[model samples]
Target chain A: MNTKAFEKLNYTLSLLSAANGDKHHGCIINSLHQVTASYPAKFTVTVNKDHETYQAIKASGSFSVTLLAADCPEGLIDCFGYRSGRVKDKFAEYAVKTDGMGNPYLMEHMVARISCKVVDSLDIGSYMLLVGEVTESEVLGDGPVLTLQEFTNRGKTTPPAATVYRTMAGNGFRCTVCGYIYEGESLPADYVCPICRAPASKFVKQD
Target chain B: MNTKAFEKLNYTLSLLSAANGDKHHGCIINSLHQVTASYPAKFTVTVNKDHETYQAIKASGSFSVTLLAADCPEGLIDCFGYRSGRVKDKFAEYAVKTDGMGNPYLMEHMVARISCKVVDSLDIGSYMLLVGEVTESEVLGDGPVLTLQEFTNRGKTTPPAATVYRTMAGNGFRCTVCGYIYEGESLPADYVCPICRAPASKFVKQD
Candidate 1:
């Protein structure tokens, strides 16, 4: 559907976490955005209905957002984003603080922390869009906050099975050493990164 | 509500425009954001119900998005934002060209041009949330695409009567010549911009 065109819209990457009683969950999300800009500022986040994070947010009616830094370590993303929060205590390994409702917001490799109370929500097919009125917020540090394009430029790819997302047409190898993803029909035996000049041996094929 | 805390959630600025037959409309919007990243990359935009631009998007079922440049002129914001689209033809005075859908996207002071077809919508109180599947997009230039924090740092102020946006706490003076707003209970007679170095003599009371 000429979906490659969709790559033009840019967004910041963040983690949305929530707690319900003793159960707490978080997930990676690129869809967090501001809706209203005045006092009681509003934000909307879209989540897959089946995720444990979604369950926590729906039950608690509140969530915490941590804005990731540009140099955010891979371990943090793997812990909070790639792994399921229901399986373990995601905050156990990290430095953190709790909000009034006891939801955890990261204090490491993060630029800001925000707490919000869900004021409205909508069901959209496989997902639920939660609109929250920010209850408390604080800037943790300076930025440029990491962006979706920068994530891709760093060679991080989203699995198509998970989202209705669109990337540059075709697929190929990613230079894992530098996060410079190379898209093509096939990988050359001796190819190297245009940016980092790394060798083909460092490239991994896109799944 | 200690809304000053809400300053932590920052956003990018862009222009959302659509064509309805021979009529066209565009408005300054900071709420456009990606909702998904794959296939038909999807985005959501929140629009005030009363704006002509919203009516045009609904009637046309499509819209053009222009990611504006960091150095976007004050005149452009005044024309598309401060003025009502129903009252005048905004593009008549701006440099622009038509996209594949025969829709006009700005050519000057833009980082990219994107065309989208509305896929879904929801009524959210005073605003409508439009979901758009991007149909075509192309980079227009290099960017540090403008961020909301930069907009305010450049001296732009949100009208308190508008959306639920948050800014620095307390009330103070603004340097009229530079658009640099100074916040506090009162203005100092010897104050000067840490940026432009404009003196307090140029500062005016905040409304």
Candidate 2:
């Protein structure tokens, strides 16, 4: 299989935490996830060690998975994406609430929410795969679910420091055309036959 | 680790998906996944061969994951959650596009789009784990990415037909709360529990 094509489909899902009533209110978590069961719904979201959501789920025992819609305002993603809950009041500006299970959620920005109980967790090196069972759910409104493409097209870019660190620390390389980080940087640079390799020139430092 | 709690969590999650998607889509999948840095930013999605997504992923070697926001509108989750793509165009009414690779994305619907190439697949009983690498990525806008609570509350009033199926199937003795099919179609009045030992009043019928 073409690895490049595979990477293209993986989504950088934004995980929302319920308003924790702390200085570090609602934070954004970028997780790599896959739905395990649609009926008796189950999903596995892998959270990296560096992300705050990982700690939240570990401490709280459960978290919510809200799917972002395409029409969602740019500021929502920006505020949650760029600002760290550690320093900024992530939920200070938004209307958020707690769910039946006590998990926090952004009431206005999401299309759906699933409140889950942590059933199992596995340690996969730098990340932890937390398997959750859906106990409750809600579908707020309807619009197109956001695609990674649309999210990238927006002028908002990851801070240079984070981008560069993610590029070098991870296997992805910076895209020359767009600043997308192709997670295949570990491959030999000389090998270039099947796909277009973003030369080192294309990369810019990520924040 | 409390296996029972995990089981409960898993059971509840399956129920939520059922309520949202319903059985019209067939069996649901359950599994955990993680994104790893080997090359191409590989991630894994576990699915059941008996489910619709599993079949689609196997047939197409690709599938799109729409992260539903906590505030998702009505009928949106049902649109993607309930219907089977094999029988219909999941994105017929919506605008969508394929990335540098062949993975299809909903144009501006998602927070980000990830086109994946199925590098390897693993089978675990009823589920198939699809592992792929992230080739292309685009961030559209930002917000508090969607969580599960938002989804559950999005369609809170919807009947729990799917939930019934989740519990019955995951545990023993056809747990009606989740809808596991019982062994004896016409259970005796004094029938005892096979899975959770719940009373007969809890069992409900999907058929």
Candidate 3:
């Protein structure tokens, strides 16, 4: 699975946060899915175990999803991207509020906010498939939501250290059902017994 | 689902490409996997129905995976990130070559290359899971590979319009065993037979 493959899928940059003090803290990530009809929208995300964001998600059963706007302030992107929430209280630096359902929403710029309750989780080699229900929802503004292309066109930068690691491992097949790593010959014909062996019907590529 | 949910799972990012004649198009994608024990490793990638890169992948039959260095050139990133293979030959801008198995590889700054043969494809809504057999593999450099964090940190931008669409449609889960949404809500112990009456054990998430 290569970044190019993931790139082909359209997605939005979002931040998932859990209630913290009078606000919420979380990590910025991307998604190309809509689970609205399915009360609890099942989703998959990659979190470095060492990051504060990952710790926050594990501790809190609830998280907030703020759909980033294409026109969001560069400072906002930097606040979330260039800096880590572990060392500094990022929420304190900006206007924040706990949503009606206790989730946090940045008062800065965004398109929508969805508060979710954790439903299930899948442990991949290093990441987790976090399944949650959309407990609360809010639409902020109109117009197209910010996209990966928009984020990149804005000249955003990738974290230096992470970039290197992604390059070394190379891209490969990802188990859509369990987020497992299948770095081998085209998934076994049966493709049903590698890990959970849910069956060939359950896998999706990271691309 | 939102990007916040997806970010919790830390995954790596890499480049995937398919060569045809003098033209080669690439895409930036993620991989939820670990390297294999075999020298000629194998892997798979998901190709979307809407991406220009998917066409190149189908036409070429084989693709190359390039691991971008931590401090890779932005120009290099944009060449693959912003441009569409549908309109131009992206490889024309870079030095490239076909490996022993015939997959394309960037001439400079890549950590390795893995050539795969398409084995099977599973359609899940708008995207297709491209299962490929690893026919050839090579390691080009020794360093940390890039994770999703590094790609995001480098401030890689995205196509806002396409991204938003992807958000409304990707990384969604549908139970493979039973084709249910798995929304955290418990099914009545006696609940049975709406789609398939396989019982609770059969329901799986669409990862």
Candidate 4:
């Protein structure tokens, strides 16, 4: 198989956010799609089971999706894509608004925001495909939406500082499932990944 | 709902194809996503149940996906998208190749091709989300993948001739579910959409 061919399949990057009580979590995801165009249009999002946002959606049964704009900064991608919400408050640094369903969604550098209620879910081993029915939607801007290929191109110029530093430190154990890095001397045998909830055995020490 | 906002959320266009015995069919779809990055990568494609390609996949349990390149001609999209494979042999005019499973995939104006077997599926009203486990993949070219926005922009310059003629004739009826237009003088009570299988009741007579 030509593994590199998969990279040519461009996906639009979006911010997926959910709330459980007063706690809100957001993550960057590229696996969002509108499955149907009928009334109460249906959507599907694939989230890693270990993500805090995934847990939030499971507990709240709702989530908001914001399609990133072409001008979205690399820093926002870093904060939402690379960092784990278990240790940091992603919304603290960004302007956010609650959708009609009470789920938090980003308010800047996005082309559109859609609120959805989880109707059903399918488990695909490490990931869960959440089928959601659109509860509310808004077109926020006219800017072109960002694609994963464009994001990768931007990173080629200057990689995310946090990711670069963590990888260079050589003290990080990366979660093989979700790419979450745990920095320490050695991973605890019973440690579970805060991001994807994978066991310590699923991590490989950074080289 | 700001319905116009949905227009800004660009999606990558893909050609979904499948075969059952000696018959082959293909359709254009945008709701395709890579849900997992494991050894046998997983993907999810939402296909309208009425589509001939969807039925072919259901019968054969496998399909091929080709990501359209930026330079892909509008005529190809018009043929694979607006026309029904149930009445026309879509592969007749195009060069094609079969995968390990004997599913035909497009060979031109595409950036990549992936062959997958349906591992699971979820029903969401009029659409079925087919979870595919990659059996083989190949990068066909280095060109950028096409996006729905780009296609729309191209269409604005010149609408598909078949669609324009059908709509202008005033004798056509459009499937409310999948936008498949049926050209005829009158609707038959027992008629079911050849594209989406929606009954005559689901068709709206063009004004």
True contacts kept of each: 0.33, 0.06, 0.00, 0.60
**Individual DockQ of the candidates?**
0.25, 0.08, 0.03, 0.43
TM-score: model 4 vs. ground truth: 0.84
TM-score of each: 0.72, 0.47, 0.43, 0.84
Q: Report the lDDT tens digits of candidate 1 across residue range A1-207.
A: 333434545566777888877866776677677675323467788886756778888888899988878788878776665555545677788767788877878877887777888888876555677888778887776766776667778787642212335334467775543344688878888886774466788676665
Runs in model 2 deviating more than 4 A are: A1-3, A10-13, A18-34, A155-207, B1-40, B49-207
Alpha-carbon runs more than 4 Å astray in model 1: A1-5, A69-74, A86-88, A142-144, A149-207, B99-102, B142-144, B158-207
- Shift in Å, residue B189, candidate 3: 28
Write the number of the candidate with greater lDDT, choosing between 2 and 3.
3
Between 1 and 4, whose DockQ is larger? 4
Tens digit of per-residue lDDT, candidate 3, span A68-164: 7778877776666545554556677777878555656684577777776666554433344455555766666654466554566557543211211
Judge candidate 2 at residue A116 and give its lDDT. Answer: 77
Q: Write one digit per residue (lDDT tens) for candidate 4, span A1-207.
A: 766777777767889999978999988887777776544577788787767888999999999999989998888987788777777888998877999878998878999998889999998876788898878888887788987778778663211111111223557787865676788889999999875467899887776
TM-score of chain A of 2: 0.67
- Return whichever of 3 and 4 wins on DockQ: 4
Clashes of each: 13, 125, 64, 4
Candidate 1 global CA lDDT score:
0.69
lDDT of 2 by residue, A1-207 (tens): 222222223233444563333423344443424343234455566554445555667777777767666577878876766555445566677776777767777757565666777777765545556667768776754654554534656755542112111334545554332234555635455533122233555443332
Interface RMSD of each: 3.6, 10.1, 9.6, 6.3
State the lDDT of candidate 4 residue by residue for B1-207, as single tens digits. Answer: 765655666677888999978888988887667776544578888777767888899999999999999999878887787777756898899888899998999879999998999999998876788898889989988889987778778653211111111224467877854576688888899999875466899887776
By lDDT, is 1 or 2 better? 1
The number of residue pairs in model 1 that clash at the backbone is: 13
